[model samples]
Target: MRIMMLKGFLVAALLLGTSLSHAKPLVLSSLKPLTLIAQEIAGTAADVDTLLPESASHHDYPLKVSDYSRLQKADLFVWIGPELESFLQKPVANLPATKILTAYDLPGLFWPDEASVSDDHHHAKDPHLWLDARNAVTVARAITEKLIKLDAPNTDLYRKNLQVFASKMHELDNRLLAQMKPASGVGFAVYHEGFAHFVSHYGLRQLDYITFTPEQKPGAKHMQQLRERLSKDGSCLFLEPYNNLQATRDLAQELHLRIGTLDALGTQSTKTYSQLLEQMATDFLTCLTNVRH
Candidate 1:
């Protein structure tokens, strides 16, 4: 009877251990940039996942029932705040306060040049804060702080990973600043206003843009006005990989100006968050300089 009891106890203990090991850490992100930064701080110890796909426009991203389900499972949720992804507002508010972190709340980041027009939930602030390497540093630190608090047992590991992430981010910021020094205020325009964060950090100027949101394409009248603006000062149109390529191309052709594609949201191969910033800086600088000459 003693042997049989011991065997039963051992079996139960083994099963419980397996169950605990299989339980995953809950992490949810609303954007690709946050997803990448969370993964770095999470350090293989958490299940970091993103809600947005590569091609979805944040301006009109449709929220689904599954998104709410995903949020329910998250121990912590990271989002760009209501300015960028207000679609998540209702659901996120329904979540317990302890479970969500908004990157917009972070300090030491610069707002868009036109504050009155920024954060309007319409044609307003550029939601692409990750494009600014310095902002990414703030985001990574926030992620690390949250992860350490939630997963104290692994605090040391999170700290170490965050340090590595921040170092790489700083390096990228320096690179971007150096590369854009010559192009500052050269005045390029974009099909959309997403480049505000990028240009704001580098001290570059955007002569004009269609709008902050990609939901509404400019009408013919607005297009003519933009053309007139560009005609007076030969400026290149910055395009995004996921935007209406043909329209932008046509605009470029019509005005006889150069056009370049920017990957505001990094790719699967972007791998790390820092690489995304480097890519944007390099691409923008190259595009602007080529057009100038």
Candidate 2:
């Protein structure tokens, strides 16, 4: 009788342990870069995942059934909001306001020049706020504060992580600024205008963008105008991994322009926010400064 009773208690204990292990708060970010930021703050206290795959386009993502299910179960949902991921607005609307975080809503976001805003896209704000490290610090603090409230037991850990993140970002900010200093006057073009935050942060010069969104093809007249403009003064054309590479390549070749690749999503970097920023800086320097004239 005693042996049988001990066996039952052990099985119950095992089951309880499994249940507890699965109870970690799940944080779902709309994009990989935001996922990295959430993971850095959440650490082992919560489970963090990105809703969109690395290959998916953030500008025009179609929601799947599984995405809805995931959002329904999420303890927190982080996204760039409707300006970037309009498809998520309806699904996220169903979630409690406390459970949803919009990156663009964070304070100290960089807005593009009024004159530069595209009428075609009709976007009031630049959704790529994460590219700026200062903005990223704001995002990390917001995530940490929310996670601390959700997981009180892990408050100390979350605060500690936030401090570490802030310190590292401060150091990285100076380092990246120095690294980008030489490339300040270098003229570069992009497939999309998503790099405004990055360029404005480091004072780099961007010639122009082929399109506001990658999916939109430049009309023949626009392409001819771009070719003419680029032929006279363009230094290099930077393309994103998800952009229409063939079109970019054709445009680059037509103008005899140097080509460089920038991955704003941090898809190619290790699963860390700092590494993503470093990788972007490296990509910019390597392509913009290293390419022979």
Candidate 3:
């Protein structure tokens, strides 16, 4: 009886040890895209949360008192740096260097405005780097690295998740490469110059944009200039969320172009980064083929 009780106590102790594993680390991301990346690495090993809503523009997002508290409670914070979220510069500066990760800090990230894309295809430095799967993989590795350091108990899980994320990203890249090949050299315009990373990554031709900033409406003369230039070569005009849908419809009708909306902020249903990019490619192909989604 004593020997049986000893074995039972040992088993119970082991079970208790397994049950009382490391606490789940909280990774707070500035955007949904980053949050998705973090989620891939964190999985069930950590809790992932997004700091910004999909509806708000990162350029001028108003931070609330609650936002500060969230930032404080997080074990790690990830963002795209001042280039994208200028509003975060001051607040994130308060965090320790070890706790905060940004895109500018990562190497091998493809910035479209740089030598990554053609001059004709590229416009300016695009802050939306997560549009590229390769860049997203890079970010996933960084997040895993930090997670492993912060939550050492789940290092294996984090590392394995990173591998899976990278593999999926490669699969996504290959699929997108083939899918976009059909639409390559096809001229499409956007509401703003934000899709350069996705456009250049997939080799689609972006002819022109309606505005530099989404809120900055071009004057009549400027509109006329775009109209004259694009009326000849532009085949499709893509609008994004928050764009004036009626105006885009009018312009598309005037230009005799197909219409589609490319969402930089992934939809309510978008759970993964791969899903977001795949949806973008599908939307692009649909627009090119004149099959609106």
Candidate 4:
């Protein structure tokens, strides 16, 4: 009877240990684009989620009481660093270095031109690094490295997922280049300079940007530059998700431009990063072709 009871206790302990070992680690990202990248790496081995709502601006996102609890509980938190999500800096500063991964610290990330980077370190560091395909692969690898440290048991799974993500991004890079070729001649205007990486990457023609960042109003000088350019041709005016609707519509009307929405945040329901990139290219082509001179 003693031996049987001891055996039962050992069996129960073993099953509990197994359950603990199989529990998925939660990977929380600051933005949806980063979440998509992380989900690609985490695969089914981990649960990936985003902190910011799809409609919220990264510039000034308010943290709730529950958000702090989530941050405390998350096994790993990923963010693009102070340049983009400045609000998260203080909340995550006290977290153990191991629990947080900043995409800006990741290798091989592309940055904007020196002018675009601006003197204000807090405001401009080309936070839209994910707009480049190459940076996405780098981010995936860094995420995989962090996950391996957190959950070594899933090393092979994370590595395999990273490989798949890299291959898919490579294919996407080529595909976007080809797809954007026809729209190369379509002169366009963006609300801000955030899309520079993507535009330059795929060789898209952007006549000008109204501002350096979304929150700022378009400077008179920049507006003059755009007026000189867009006045000659009817082209697409690509606006970001955060741009004011009435103001943008009025501007588009003033410039005789066709409006197209570019969800740079990837806020729309896209199951995969590939879909996100494809959607961006499609939106560009659709708007550009429709607004030809």
Candidate 5:
């Protein structure tokens, strides 16, 4: 009887300990690539949540009433800056600063603009910095730090995961550099000015962009200018998957140029973030070379 009781107690204790260690702290309100990187670092340890769904646009996102209540429950909340997801600013400010972090600090892309007419896209200095793999590494490291600090028990796992992720990003940078270096001085124009880091890292010229930013379409004069510029430069018109296509197609047809749609957001189901980086580098090489001069 004594042996059986001891065995039963041991089994019960083991189950209780397992359940306690695996219990997850709620992380709430993720946006865009920052969420993806956070999920990668957190793995299955915590319940990672996103207020905005994958398909939803981060810019001009409205907060749900339920989200306000949910924010009260979060152990940690991650978001891009005011440029991207400003809706969360007021609520997040109420929380301790340690619980809130901005992924935009992870090295943003630079856009050169002498153009006039400040539109929605040019409003916040390009918040799509997380699309770049190099920037993604910075994001991942920041997230890992938070996760480790919040849950020290998983420190080893987070560090290991971050190291692996960083290594992959470094390898991707090298691979892209090799592929893009040969095509030096190549010029191309995106529908928006989101790819500053991408173009700069690849040494491509992006003198004119059609859309002021991803969320807003260009005006008539801007379209005409872009069309004329495309015809003269022999560079391809790169459209983003999430962008409004009517203006882009109109300009492409008018200029008799082919359109290349790059997946800036890296679709939720199709390509993993790392694979998308490789695909983008390949697309740039292919598109720049194939365009008719």
Candidate 6:
């Protein structure tokens, strides 16, 4: 009787251990783009979700009451850091250092030309670093490393996912380069400066930006200057989906220029990170190449 009772307890303990070992880690990312990247690396090893909604802006997102609980419960929290989501600073301060992964610290990031001399209080650093494919590769690797540290049992799977992601990105880079060939010298203007990294990477021309940030409307003097510039050589004007459409439409109509839409947030179709990049490249090509010359 004693031997049988001990055997039953041992079996129960073994079963509990097995279940715990196979449990998936929870990863919380700050935005949709990062969530997509994390999902690529996590595969089936972890559950990943984004804190920000599709319609929200990363620059000034308000943290809801439930967000604090989500952040606290997350095994790993991934974000771009204070340069982009300053609202998260105080809330994430209590989280352990090991629990947070800041993508800004990742190598090969592209900063704006004026970021070096500009004060942080005055000029905001362009937080759209994911626009550059090279930066995305670095970020994906960093995420994989963090996931491995958090969930050792899934290290092999995470590493394998990273390899697949890198391979896919390489193919995307080549495809986008070939597709954007016609847009190389085509002059265009944007409502904001978020596309600098992407435009520079593809060797495309951005004649000028009407506003440095999306939240702020361009003053009359700035609008006039942009109008003058576009009147001379601009083939198209790209407006962000989140920004005020009326202003962009009015400006485009006034300048007699073709209008195109750019969604830097990856809100349109986000089934996968690869899909997001493909859609963005398609939008760029469709707008720039189809412009009325």
**Better structure of 2 and 5 per lDDT:** 2
Best by lDDT: 3
- Steric clashes per prediction: 0, 0, 0, 0, 1, 0
Ranked candidates (TM-score, high to low): 2, 6, 3, 1, 4, 5
State the lDDT of candidate 2 residue by residue for 1-293, as single tens digits. Answer: 99999999999999999997658789999999899888879888899988997799988888999989999888999999998888888898899999999988887765655353323445556688899888888999999989987889899999999899889989999999998988887777888878888887788777778887777887887677667767877878988877756877987888778888888888654678888888888888877788432
lDDT of 4: 0.81
lDDT of 1 by residue, 138-192 (tens): 8888888888777788889989998897888777778778878877755567867
Model 3 CA deviation exceeding 4 Å by range: 1-22, 113-124
Indicate the TM-score of model 5. 0.79
Q: Model 5: per-residue lDDT, tens digit, 1-293?
A: 99999999999999999997667766764664566677777878767777776666666667788887777777788887776667767877888888877876655433423232224334545666765677788877887888888888989998988898889878888878777775565556777766666766666666577766566767887877666667787466787767758867876777766567776556665335676666677666677777422
lDDT of 2 at 210: 85
Which runs of model 5 end up more than 4 angstroms from their true locations? Answer: 1-22, 106-125, 291-293
Ten-residue region with minimum lDDT total, candidate 2: 114-123
Consecutive 10-residue window with the lowest summed lDDT within model 1? 115-124
Q: What TM-score goes with each of the models?
A: 0.86, 0.89, 0.87, 0.86, 0.79, 0.87
After TM-score superposition, the amount by which residue 284's alpha carbon in candidate 3 deviates from its true location, in angstroms, is: 0.4
- Estimate the lDDT of model 6: 0.82
Q: Which residue segments of model 1 deviate by more than 4 Å?
A: 1-24, 115-125, 291-293
